[model samples]
Each structure stands twice: as structure tokens, then as C-alpha cells.
Target: MATIGTHSGAFQADEALGVWLLRQLPQYESAPLIRSRDMEKLKPLTIVIDVAGTYDHDLLRYDHHQRGFFETFDGENKAAKDGGRPDVTGPETATGEFKTKLSASGLVYKHYGREVLIRLHPSLSANPDALDWVYRKMYEDFMEAIDGNDNGIELAEAVRYKESSTLPHRVHRLNARWNAPKDGPTEDERFETASALCGAEFGEMLRYIVECELPAREIVETALRARTAVHASGRARSKRYELERRHGLPAEGLVQFVLYPDSSGMWRVQAVTVEGTAFTNRLGLLEPWRGLRDAELVARSGIDGCKFVHATGFIGGNATYDGALAMALKTIEGGSTSVELK
Candidate 1:
């Protein structure tokens, strides 16, 4: 029965995302949305975002165009006359004070984004810590760019070249061009297109954080906690046997290189891809063994059971667990000199 009001005419990513976020809530799932600037029509609306001349949270009015309006997530500078101290302690303020501006999308996200995420994935609600972490991480990774752009916060002191491929720029291009034909799509149609564009991007980002990045973090934390069990130096680890089926995640989720006993009764060391996706390793084997094999590798490294190191320095293997552990430890210790085994 409630109505959501935003500005009419060309829409920006801020208002588009703001409206989309509101629709995700149960109360507003099917609520009618009115785009108008007339106060008379907006007065009866349940919530107004990005257009009203006021920003009263009690009344559900979210706008940032007013003068002397700087609000952050943690209320660190919400009351300061000049945006408060730059050293405020908070995830949003960890970088600096200039990042405190909250646009309409930011306002909605700060207030209700976590609930929205949980609604999308009910499993996240079970883990309060994961939910909290993803909430902050989403702000840092995705929403901050939208907020900064909408608030006109300069990211750099100066720019030597212009950039046209940013998400905002691409969304803006969805509008009717200056040279568009008179029979071109109407302003409302253009707005719908832009809204869909922004909505799809927002959904994709949420899915990635929820399904991919968050799970990888847990795997990494588990491996880091149990690192000492794999090697005395705590520098080598092999989750190939321990965490293989536990989370349905590959061993590469945590370590740079893994040491495991091969099927031929020989121990092997192999590089773990970064983040389980990148080609680069978290840490590479020593340079001396790189591109060498068999006798050459064994002679240069002076370690028994020495195998070949990849030419790209991403991986290596040895014939024994101790040899693999030695290689992993030497690489972790900067690989400047040979490691003396006990």
C-alpha cells in the first residue's frame, strides 16, 4: 500500500540502486514507485529517496544534495560541523575522512543492506560474523565506488587522462544521446534501461561475495590456524588430505604451495594458485631450482630427492616429505640461501 518516490527525468546509478534496494524489502516488494519532484505528490509517499530537499531518517527521507550534510555508516562524523576528525576509527573511516559521504544508494545500503543480503541468501543469516564481514566487505568492494561517484568525492589529486569506461559512465551512456533521433526511446524507457543495468551489476557483485569470496575466506582461515601441524616451521601446509572434502573446496583455497605424499610413496610439493583462480602463486619456489630437473636440480639445491622447479617459478616437487618441507620453508624464508635440514 506504500509508495516509493524518487526524482523524475534522467536517473543516475544512485537513485536507480536506491529504488532497487527498497524493492528487495518485504514491505516494498510490490509497492508502487512514483518519480516526481512535486512536493504535493511526494508528501503522501511512504518513503522518498534522492530528491527531497531534506534528509530526515525518522521520516525515511534520504537525500544528499543539501548543504552541510555529511553522514557516515558508523556515525563517526554525523554530528561534526566540518566532517569531524580524519582519524576516526571505523572500517568506513579506516582509509580517510573524505570517504564519509553517503549518497542515496549508500544511505539505503548503510541502513538495510545487510538484511537485503540475508534475504537473498538465508544461509548467511545463520552466521552473524560472516554476515557482518560480508556487509562491510561489500561496502568496501562495491558500494564505496557508487557512493564516491555520486557524492563527487575526488579519488585522486589530479588526472592526466580521462576515463570513459567506468560503470557510472557506461550507465550514463544508456540515456538518449544528444544526436538521438526524435523518434528515439522516451526518457522513461532510457531510465528503465539504466536501472536494469545497475541492478544486474549489483546482483552479480552480491552473488560473487556470497558464493565465492566468503567461502574462500573460511578455508584460508582454517588452513592458517592449522599450519603448524603440516610442518615444524609452520611455513608449509598440505590440505590435500585434510580439507579436501570438508568444505567441498580445493586445497588451493589457502596455501601458496602444498606438500603432500604422492601415490608412488614420494612426497611432492606444488604451488597453490592464488585465490584458487589466479595463475600466479601466493609464493613461488626458489629461483635456483627453477627450470632445472633431476641431476641438475639435485646438485644445485643440494637437497636429496630434489625434483624439478617450474621455469616460471610457480611450482616444484621433491621425493620425500622432509625435502618438500625444506623447499617450502626455504621459499618462505626469502630463498636467498640454502636451507639446512635437521
Candidate 2:
């Protein structure tokens, strides 16, 4: 029977998530979890996280609090070990250098994330590309924050105000409060609460990636491939009618705008919904032509065969495909009329 061990006090997101990730593996699914700080109590455990003072991948010991310990996703002490390798840095962080200060959760994820993802969603196991994409995307979207917060890495320079709503902060609050009743939940109980919270969030993220985001990627890929057919300018189109029926894809922030031919045979350049789950485009038509229509829009845009540019600039219709392409291109280029219209 395998066993996992961690510190016996209030658990942070790192350890909680680390333990949850371990449980996802078949070897550790039913393993007994012992929480303690004493070395003797942890001696028999197969894995130790967040409390052991040493980090040895082969030995399955993960801890980050030890002095002079610098391990990253690519391994340990990457900058010094690799002599400043150029590609060691990941695209997600853009830290400009290797040697990310990893937390216990990060160490576990770095080693077993892909395997865990495949276990959670077996369909992804067959598609190496999708599995790889989800593995990296999950780290970027979820795990990096835990690693960064645990390591005390300044996410960004204090521009104005600090961000208060982070996952690590929320998890930290789950611990039994200092001012709570004297007979409140025990440390072990609080640890279990944290584990459950982290595990629930982790499962929800996996479900979203597998159910929603993955299918959306397929649509985005298809749209990218058919961009040339939409217009010669090569701008991707999320055909509202098709996407709405097929996947109900959210277009606003996810997609800039969609170009489709209107019922009048004129091509329409419609702005996607930016405010809510509706049909309002965030980057509406240029300011100058906002309240203008038909000929007035054509005059300001310097494009012919113009049908109408809505007063709110949420949509515009042009008589020809070239005209709609010009509108979309000009809008994306920030109202620049200098684009060479074909």
C-alpha cells in the first residue's frame, strides 16, 4: 500500500493541489495520506511534499522552502545548469530567463501533468497534440499562479494597485481562522477542506478544457484555414450563424469580429459581442463614422459600394466582398485609411 505525506498544519494551495494531483494517478488513487512534519512519521511514505527539506525527483521528494533550491519546469537550476539556454523559458510566463521558482504543486505538475490530464480525460490520451496543448495550457492558466504566488515572484511591477483576488489567496483563507471558535475544525479537517476546494476547482478546469475550449480550438483552426476563402486579406471569420448552431462560440473577446455575406448579397462586417453574451462588438466602427449611414459612411471610409455603417458602429454592410474586407482591415488597423484597398 503506497502512502503520501505532507506537513500537518494549515495547507496552502501548493500542497493541497500536489496531493490531489498525486491521487489522480492509479498508483496513488487509494493511497493513505499521512499529514505530519516529523521526519520519522514520513519515512515510510512513498512521496513527501511541501515539508521535506530536500527535492529529489528520483526519490519522489518535493519541497521548495530549502535555501539555494532553484528548480524549474525544464529541471533544476536551469540557467546555471544549462549555461543560460535560450529556449528554457516558457512562452506562458515570458520571464525572459529560465529557472522559475517552483512550488511543490509545480514540481508535481512538471513531472506528472500530462499523465494526470490523460487519466482525467482519456480521450485526450489518443491525441498527442491535444494532450500536449492542454498540459501546457493548464499550467499557464491555473498552475503558474500557484507557483508564482508560493515563490513570492512579483507577477508584474506595481503599476497602480495590487490584485487581491488570486487563487492562492483564496485557498489560504480556507484555513481555520485565528479568531475562530477554540473548538473549531482541527488542522487535519482544514487541510481536507483545502484539498477538496483545490480538487473541485482543478476538476472544473479540466472539464472546461475538455468540453468547451477544446472544441472551440477545432473551430478556430477551421476558421484559420478558411480565412483566405472568407476574404483575400486572410482575416479569420467566426461565422455567427454557423458557430452559434454548431458550438455557440463566444465571439467578443475570443474573436475580434466576424465577416459574412448579408442577405442583400452585400458582405457584412459585424462586430462581435464585447459587453455580454450578446451581439455587441467591443471594438465598434471607427469614431468618425459612428453615427453615419450609407453614403456618409462611404465618404468617411473612402471605400465605394458601401451600404451602411450602424450608428453604434456595431455592424457595417458593404456591397462587395472587397468593401467588407476593407472595412474589417481598416477597423483592425485602428481607423487607418492608409491601407491599400484592392
Candidate 3:
């Protein structure tokens, strides 16, 4: 594992930054402008750093304090809550000999074979830029230090956090946000989702996609042909199908298909789903057909253009499904049919 080890001074120094800065002392001008005594009260600065190829290691430090009025080692231990130092580092002293508030700390990066340690100070965290710079510097310095000297021990693949093993919640939150839904895809929303699912699958799961796509397409085509035959035979009067598919199809929940006829005699089936999950069964139905209609239904949604129809107080003049599809297909296929959404 890649880990770091350091003395207690580093940790205390990190916490002292806020306390010293909030205090009325005039010694440190670069300290953060922290007004609250609570470390949690500090407004966290939003920062994004790129750690493309490298992972972090473990950090270890001694939690003891040095004798003085008060001093912060790192931005982490300004007003330490753990009153006195333990037997881990040095011998105990009088209660007031040193300010029990802040303590020392350090991080250890277990590079190739040896451990590279980086000392931390409190002032670094108080400022966002400083904190980032310190972390990057430490990473570089640790890598360089390990390259210079190795003790024959081989490094492992894991990055262990020896001290406070908790990773920042902010990182997880950012990742979730990155994977959240935005808007519908212009071509087919289902395709986008399928693509994402396929990309996330691993090992054998990835292989299942190749075996499924062909059969799925056949199902979709069959469903489309059935719908067309019904239209031609006049069994179904409505040419417009709902954009959502129901659970009749096994993969109905996986993909959505819409079928709409243009002015042309040919019916177009639009398979809209994520990339790899675009499989259809013999019914020309997509797998993701959960109560939602497939993209194939869109072709049956009357005409592409919007238009308004005025009522002349006539009896029984409602449009039938067969006429609608025929009119739509004609208009779309460059025939003399005209329809509008407005």
C-alpha cells in the first residue's frame, strides 16, 4: 500500500491555523479569517483537482504537542479537543506547559518500496489555494523522495489512509452529481441510457450485449409489422401510438420504441434507448418497455407539423386512427397531404 507516516506536530499544526487567525494576535497576517470557534463552522471552499493517474496513500502522524503559549501545526488541529498527549510519542508534561489545543501531524506515502512523509501546517487548509498547492507539492515530493531512496520493499496497489481513513464526502457528492440526469437526448433518450449501461457492465455482463442486440431488433421489427398490418386491415382505427411502452414485452423496461408513419407508405420505427441495451425481441419490442412506450410509437403520432383545426358544429367528425396514419405518412413521404400541430 502507498502510505505516509509523520510525527504529531504536523497534525496539530494543521488545526491551529483557524484558532491563531481568529485570535487577536498580529503575528500571522496570512492566517484564515475564521470567526467561529467550531472547526465545522468554517465555510468549506469548493475546489476541483485532477488526480487522473495517481491515487492517494495513507497518512500517519504523532499526536503530541510542543511546549509553548499556543501554536497551530497544520490547519487541522487549531483548538484540539483531546486534552493531553498520550504515551505514543514523548513523555507527558504539566497541563499548562504547552497549549493542549493543537498537535503535530504528518502523512506517509508508501511509494515503490520506501515510505515518503510530508509535514503539514495549519495555514494550508485555511486557504483553498494553499491547501491544494500543499497537497500537490507533497505528492510530488513524496514520489521524488521514494525514487531517490528505496529499502528493497515492494509497494502494493492500494492507497491506505493510516490516520483518519475517511475520504472527504465532497468527493462522493461530486461523483454522484456528475452521474445525475440532465435532459432528454435529441435523437433517442433511450439510446443514451443504454450506452451508459453498456459502458458500466463488466466481464461476462459485457459479452451478453452482443448476443442480445440481433434478436432484440427482430422483435422490434415484428411489432412494427404487426402494427402496420393491423392498420392496413382496418382493425385499428387510430394510427397514433403512445410514445411509452407497457410491460407486455420482457425488455419493455430496457428500451423505448416509437412507430410513426410519414407521407410515404413505409412505416419508420425509431429505437430510442441506451447504446448496448437496444435489444428487441420478435415482437419488434425493446427490452426496456416498462409501462413506457418505445420510440417506435412516435411514427404513429399523427403528423410531424403542428396546426389547429376549427370546429364547424358538424356531427360525428372526430378523426379515426387509420385516416390519421395514412395522412401523416403521406405528408412525411412528400405526398400532397398537409397537417399541422398549430
Candidate 4:
């Protein structure tokens, strides 16, 4: 029988996830697993991961701890000002790149991810577009977090909530404690439990992306397509939906405003951000409506039912859906209104 090798003593989140991913593949489906640093033992195994000090697909040896290794999901830059360096892309670049460095889990995912997705969601095999989308989406939405956690990459360096609640932290906790008695669980036992944890989380993430996120893109797209008809300015009412989840930009890509009912049931008109750009709204709401609330907001905008427009003009609130649509429409028409809108 074939066997896989990883380092012994303690298992990590990346190796645990990598082992789980490997087990899903046919060649390794029933392969026996071994954890060891003994090169002699690892050398004869069918494959090794998170050990071996090498990353070569042909050899089936994957590890990211070695020096001179730096890779992101398609993009080489660790962090880009606009998700990419200026020279790497031009005006027509449509896709946003992931900035996290890869771990052994990422290495396994980078290779066998599509096959794994197809196996989990067999229906995806019939729809190549959806299959392709979910494949990339899974990496961005799920695997990147695993990779980031495994590599000690945090979203920001700012002082914020400091907590060890991430999956990697949870998996690390499963490792055998130093003060444990002889009756303690073996490393292999703990590793199996860690693998189960990683697998369950990965499955949950995949399900959410497939069932919830991908399908919701249609609502945003439909509203965007009806923009010209909704009004010459292209502002329409819909749920607080997301945009460009699948990167399927609507025709002309000129959607300016979205009118959605907030949690309070009050309507909010929001400016659309241009994809691949950072922090800039595609079209902001009317300047006069901003920074004023209730009666003052109505008086400033000459429109009734106005609640408030954000000081930045990126968003505004109204009492009714029709009022929200009017806010979106006025933003697209474009003119000075007491303030310079974003």
C-alpha cells in the first residue's frame, strides 16, 4: 500500500489540511499516513508534505518552509496598492489577486483543487463557467484564509481584537501538550482529530460559497442591467446585495447607485465602487444631501423623505424606497450641491 509522510512530534494546520486534501485524491484515497522526520523512511513513501524541504509536483513532495519560496495566488506581490503593481497590469485588468503566501495546504490546493471541487459538487462538472468560478472563489473565500493563518499572515497590522480563534489556532491546540501523561493521545491521534477539524471547516466554507454567495450575484447583475431603464442615471432598488462576486461585470459597467433596504427597513442609496480600484466610489450621491439628517437633509436636497447622506456622499438614507431611488438618480445626474461629492 502507498504511504504519505509528514514531520512527526507536532502537526500544524497546513499539514493537517494538506493531508486531508491528499486523502481525497484517488491515488492517496486509502494510503497509509506516517508522521516522521526520518528522511530514510520518508524517501520510500509515495509522497510527503510539510516536511521533505522541497516543493516539486513531479516528485509529489510539497513544502513551503524552505528558503527562496515566495508565491501568491497568481499575483507575485505580497500586498499591492490596488491589489497589483502598476507594471503587472494595465487599464483592462478585471481580476483582483490574492496577496497571501502559500502554505503546504495552498500547495495541495493549487494542484488538485479543481478535481476536489468537481468531486464534492459533481454538478459543477456540467457547468464549466460555474466550476471555474467556484474553483477561484473557493481559494479566495476559503483556502486563502487557511494559507494566511498557517503562514502567520494577518489581515492588518493595526491594533485590534487580539484573539486565537482562527482555525490554525484551533488545530494547533489539538497538538499533544508537553505536560501530558503517558495516557495522553498520541500525535497521530491528535493529527487525525485536527484533520477532521480542517475538513469540516473547509466543507462548510465550500458549501456557503456554492449555495449562498454565487447565486446571489444574479440579483446584483439584474439590477445593474436594468440601470438604464430604471432611470437614465441607472439607480435601482434591490436587497443589500453584493456586486461582481463572480467578476461578471455587467454591460458598460456603468452602474452608479444601489438602493437597498437597511436592517432598520429604511432605504439606503449607496455609490458603487469600481472593481479593481481601492476606496473610490464610481459615482457618489448628491453633495447637498450629505452630512444632514431628517428635516435638515430634506431641506438641503429639495427632496422629501430624505434622512441623511453620508458626509463622504458615498451613501444616503431615505424613509421610503421611492425616496432612495430618487437619491440614486440625483447622484448620477451630477452637479454641485453645497458640497463636493466623492
Per-residue lDDT, model 4, residue 102, is: 81
Ranking by TM-score: 4, 2, 1, 3
Per-residue CA lDDT of candidate 1, range 226-278, in tens? 87687555446643322444545443334446776767776777765544234
Give lDDT for model 2. 0.75
lDDT of 4 by residue, 161-195 (tens): 77788888899999877788889888799999999
lDDT of 2 by residue, 1-342 (tens): 999999887778999999999999999999989999899998879999998797888999999887556776665664434566534443343333334578999989989999899888999989998898788778766887888888888766664576777667778998888799989988878887888888888989888988998788787668855655765544336633434435444442234457778666888887765432354454676768666778887898898877887766777888887888778778877832221111
Whole-model Cα lDDT of every candidate shown, in order: 0.74, 0.75, 0.26, 0.75
Clashing residue pairs for model 4: none
Model 3 lDDT per residue over 1-342, tens place: 111122111112122211221122222223332222232332131110011111122321222223321321122222322454332222133233321222221211212111111122334335554344334343332222222212111233464444232121111222223345676332223322322332232112212322343234446445644653644432222211221132232232222224445464434333332331223211222222212222322333333322211121000111344433443333223322111111
Candidate no. 2 TM-score: 0.72
Which sequence of candidate numbers ranks them by lDDT, best first?
2, 4, 1, 3
Question: Which residues of candidate 4, in runs, are more than 4 Å off?
Answer: 75-99, 152-154, 157-163, 180-182, 235-256, 261-268, 271-319, 331-342
lDDT of 3 at 200: 30
Q: Candidate 1 — which residues are off by over 4 angstroms? A: 78-98, 156-163, 233-328, 335-342
User: Looking at candidate 3, what is the lDDT of residue 232?
Assistant: 43
Runs in model 3 lying further than 4 Å from the true structure: 1-222, 230-318, 336-342
By TM-score, how accurate is candidate 4? 0.74
lDDT of model 2 at position 163:
70
